[model samples]
Target: MLKKVRVQIVTDRFEAKGSLYETPAGKLLPTPLQDMPAKEDIEHMEMTVEASYHDDGDRVCIRYKESELSGMEGSVTSVSFRKSEPALISMLRDGSVKTALVFEPAARHLCVYQTQIMPFEVCIYTRSVKNCIEENGTLEMDYTVELRGAQAEHTAFSMRVLPVFDKPISK
Candidate 1:
């Protein structure tokens, strides 16, 4: 049987601003500033995660929805996933592995300007699992998200994972 799951995330938002420049012909050229005037603008973010395993017992499907709230308006950022080896099942069942969750950036969408952008390469890994539970034979895992991108500036954000459950409640 499949169990309905909800994961709650709490995090401290940190912000820092600086400048980047490039030299051409031995002359330094300033790049456009990120201009994040409001410190609250980049402070806090939220994400929703839903995952279910296939009935065939080989593949799993997961989705992530992230939104940032600051200023008077809020925006949704990027959403992605990761994949790992099949050993995750043994780790979870035995409870031997303190952290058994492994994820990869399977798909992602980012809001850029007035349009949404889907970058070709966006990957992430599980930084840590804060909590884990098996209730009514259902397994729930919660952790922190660590973002990774091909570029530096684009890869900066962390969100808490809500308890994501695997379907069929594996024994």
Candidate 2:
């Protein structure tokens, strides 16, 4: 069965304990990454995305207009997400956020990494631990993205999801 879900993502700044630099060396920091003060003005972004979603229990797919702002609104982008560890989904899936992006057309192992905020286009890759909270039949997911290299930007976002269901379509 296919299900409909309402997704709302709101993000502005990334409150980080320290800054991360993505270099040829790898993910690193100037000083000890832990026990540090949170940084400010890391990035500027205020976006609201509303789209149609389909989840087949095992896989989650979403399609929406190409631009949230002014545009022809004729093109749609489809994205799919698969569990990293398929076998232990129920046991270790909660509060775990991994890299997510469109699975086809212009596909890659990770999102097209960018250095600055394009205002209209917010593209950030996140592969980190997620914190989750449950409400009256709703779930909230929170995660962060970091600026890497000299021209990079970052953000921390919270996504609230509410599921909608309909009668199964008869074959």
Q: Which of the numbered candidates is closest to the native, going by highest TM-score?
A: 2
Cα error, residue 31 of model 1, in Å, equals 24
Off by over 4 Å in 2: 14-22, 30-50, 66-79, 84-150, 164-171
lDDT value for candidate 1? 0.28
Alpha-carbon RMSD, candidate 2? 9.3
lDDT (CA) per prediction: 0.28, 0.36
Model 1 earns a TM-score of 0.28
Q: Residue 149 in candidate 1 has what lDDT?
A: 28
Candidate 1 lDDT tens digits, 1-171: 343344333343333222111112222212213433355644454434443332223433322233333221232222222223321321211111112224322221221122133223222222222221221222222212222322223223333334455335455
lDDT of 2 by residue, 96-116 (tens): 122223212111122333223
Give one clash count per candidate, in the order shown.
8, 0
